[model samples]
Target: MQIGYFLSCEEYAPESLIQQARWAEEAGFESLWISDHFHPWTDEQGQSPFVWSMIGAISQVTSLPVTTAVTCPTVRIHPAIVAQAAATSAVLTEGRFILGIGSGEALNEHVTGARWPATGTRLDMLRESVEVMRALWQGDFVDHHGEHYTVENARLYTLPDTPPPVYVSAFGDKAATLAGEIGDGLVTIPPDADLIRTFRDSGGAGKPVHAGYKVCWGPDAAACVSTVRSMWPNDALPGELAQQLSSPKHFEQAGQLVTEQMIDESVACGDDVDRHLDAFRPYVEAGVDVVHVDQMGGKRQGSELEGFFAFYRDEMLPRMRELAG
Candidate 1:
């Protein structure tokens, strides 16, 4: 399995993100994953930079392949615009980018004042969006009308030698199956072996499977847990609440339901190297081809962030490779 760093856009400014990309590449990460968000999950997280501009900066600084952990092409941004941006990103990165997409969350998309559809309808929109993007990536003018979107005489003038791979994010069987049918790869968070099987069974055989996990590496486990509980209580929110919550305030209110114990149980807190490995093993065992690790401890300064990368490079990445092998 390839190990990568997950850039939490919600917690870092654009320049910090570029610096982290450099640190991650120097520290031996093979690739990168970045969250795309219009707003931070809570006021405590404090920052959310535009992801495309960040991607442009990352392309200039790091040679490592980069992907949006998942961008929502179905709403807020039209598929044509996403297609153009993604195509430009691919060209800028000299083809080191992957367009990782999903059905989208209300937190970002709701800002456009569009009605949030049911899950099934959202999935349909996502399918159509992907289809539209793929059509535009062919480097020809595209004009079409679809169930959920329209493109009128639009074309991407600048194109990469090869279009970037499209990875679809899925959280359930139906979405997983849809990913199999259309995606060049699969992206998900948890290490659900059944989800992997579902994707593979439904025509995703041999496609790359990517997963992400969050950890807090520090001297004190309790302190780390406390930090995560305060900054990322949203991680512990259950079911579709994460995708359905419409605003940062709503998320902050919902996050109040999350507990320290829950955060401790879910996140790999503190500097226990073994604990970190244990957190990642489930994804490797579930057949994930790429594993992205996001360091969670609120907003970290350069020195602290460097320390985390150094620790992972020296103590964790080698063991992770061995375990995967």
Candidate 2:
């Protein structure tokens, strides 16, 4: 098992993200998972840089392999375009890039004034989009007109020698099955063992499985919880609400329902190495091959980011590695 760092594009600026990638490597992180977002969940979070640009920047600073924790290509951009961007990223990173994708949330994809499709339709779009991307990656002009998307003789001129692996992110059983059917790998953040099993049963056997979670570390546990509570109440928003909520305002409205206690109970907060270890045990038990973690509110040095890197480098990461054993 390997431990990677997650770069949350929703909360930090591009330069800070690049710095964190370097810091993550210095802190002993083996790989990187970067969130791809067009908007922050709350206005208070206040930042959303274009992910492709950030990936290019990160590639220059760190040798760590990078994956988009999840990018949704179905609505906001054409798959042909996403394929080209990903191809360039792979080349920039020297083939150290993995395209992690999913049926995305409306909060990010609805900005183009498009009606958000239902979950089933969105998943269908995701499948077709992946198909289109893979075909384009084959270095040929591709023409595709499908149920949910269209491509007009598009081709990826810049390509990697070996196509970058596409990892599908899924939460539901049907989605998990689809991940197994099409994905080169699987991405699950919550450590739902049943979903991993579903993926394996549905032709995903032996594919790499990746998992991740978020934590806040600081001098005071209460302060940490409060910090996470303010920026990430969306963590507790139940059901398909995460995927269905169309805007930051809708999310902020729904976020009102999340209680501070909910954040404390679910997240690994504060400096307690044990609490952080407890948060990671589930993923290790679920047989995950790689587990990436994000530290919230870390945009600067000697701030939340510094404290988090210190704790993980000195305590959490080493212990987690042993536990994974």
Candidate 3:
């Protein structure tokens, strides 16, 4: 699997994100994954810039391909609007942009006061929204009056030469089946071979699969874990807590239960090159086409963007390409 840097929109400001894009290209990362969240998971993260603007700025600074780690086109934003933003992004990046979409969490979607529908209903909305976006992308006036959304006399004129591919994010079998049926690719987290197998068996065979991982790197291993625990404890929350929590403060409360050991074991905490490599092995073994690493180390004082890139450039990139081969 190829390695790419994941820009955490929730953690860094727009300027830092842009600079990281440039450094990631120089560091030999093949692609970029930028989170598309409306709010930080916790106040500790402290940043959430509009992802479309960041993509435009990043395009001006680097030639690396960009994809939203995942966007929710279902509720917080309409699918037609998302289609337009995505088209403009593709143009800005010279057609090197992809639209990764998901069923979304209430944290972002509830801002519009929209009902946080049941999971099945949300998935259905996602599927219909995708239909709306794709139909609009064809450069024809789309009139869609589906069960959840209505579109009357809508057309997207500024589309990429080819429509941007949609990569659906799935965390369970039901979602995976829907993704295989509609998505051009699959976007999921961690490295579960069973999940990948389900996608393939559900008609996603040979499609690209992108998995996300979080890791920490710092001078002191213990400190690294502490930083991760402070900034990303939400990632280790059990079951559907990550999805059901409606507010950042709620997440922070739930995160209090997460232990340092959980963060250390799940994330490759510390600067050990071998440990970092092993963190990605499960994804590779699962046949993921791209492994997007979001370095949670930046919160630690010593772990700046340059240091992070240097670690990948001098230590990880070459070995990773060999593994990908």
Candidate 4:
């Protein structure tokens, strides 16, 4: 399986950003995936730089391909603008950029005074927005109307020779099927083999499937889990992710649900190579094309990367790649 790294770009300093990307690429990571969030999801977690500018810098700094782990085209940005931004980024990266998109959250989408649409409406909007984006990316003037968008005489002028592929995110059956039907690839976090099958059956060809899991490796595993729970506790629960995503005031109550046990279950927060491989097996079996290993060490302020990446590269990655091959 392909190995990739996920960064939030929460470190605002340009040198820090370039160093991190360069380190990951030099460490044997094949691709880079960055979070596209306007806010850090909480005040304790500071820094969310302008993602597009960061991507441009990343393109120049490292040879590894970059993708937005997931960007929302439904709310904060118009689909037409997303098409343009993506086309431009792809050109800058020289065809090494893939646009990973999804129906977004209120934390990022509420900036424009637009009311957060319900889940069903958001999915509907996601489908329509993608349709509009694909049409515009074809470099033909688009005159299209749909529930969420209407584009007239719109076409991307700075289009790439081959348009960047769209990778849709989904947490359930309906959305999974939609990903298969419309997306050239699927970007998912939950390692749901069923969803992968759904994507394949719903007119989705054998396309690229990307899945990521969090790992917090250090001398102190418990301390690492504590840090993870302090930030993103909901990830601990196995089947409650969809519910957490739909929670009305999820971020406000983030601290209440995240616990040490929860973090222990979801993250590879130990020194054991066997444990790390065990954490990654489900995604491999699910037929994931690319497996993103997010070194949650960034939360601990760079204490974990040296140990984690060393173990990952020398031990776990080779075994996993053997299994995948």
* Per-prediction TM-score to the true structure, in the order listed: 0.98, 0.98, 0.98, 0.91
TM-score between model 2 and native: 0.98
Q: Over the stretch 89-127, how does candidate 3's per-residue lDDT look in tens digits?
A: 999999999899999988888998988888999899999
By TM-score, is 2 or 4 better?
A: 2
Candidate 2, 1-325: lDDT as tens digits: 9999999988998888899899999999999999988999988688999999999999999999999989998999888889999999999999999999999998889999988998889988999999999999999889998988888878788999989999999999999999999999999888999999999999999999999999988878887778877888888888888888877888888888888899889999888989999999999889899999998866422387888898999999889999998
Worst 10 residues of 2 by lDDT: 296-305
Sliding window of 10 residues with minimal summed lDDT for model 4: 240-249
Clashes of each: 0, 0, 0, 1
lDDT value, candidate 1, whole model: 0.90
lDDT, candidates in the order shown:
0.90, 0.90, 0.88, 0.79
Provide the global lDDT of candidate 4 against the true structure.
0.79
Q: Which stretches of candidate 1 lie over 4 Å from their true place?
A: 298-302
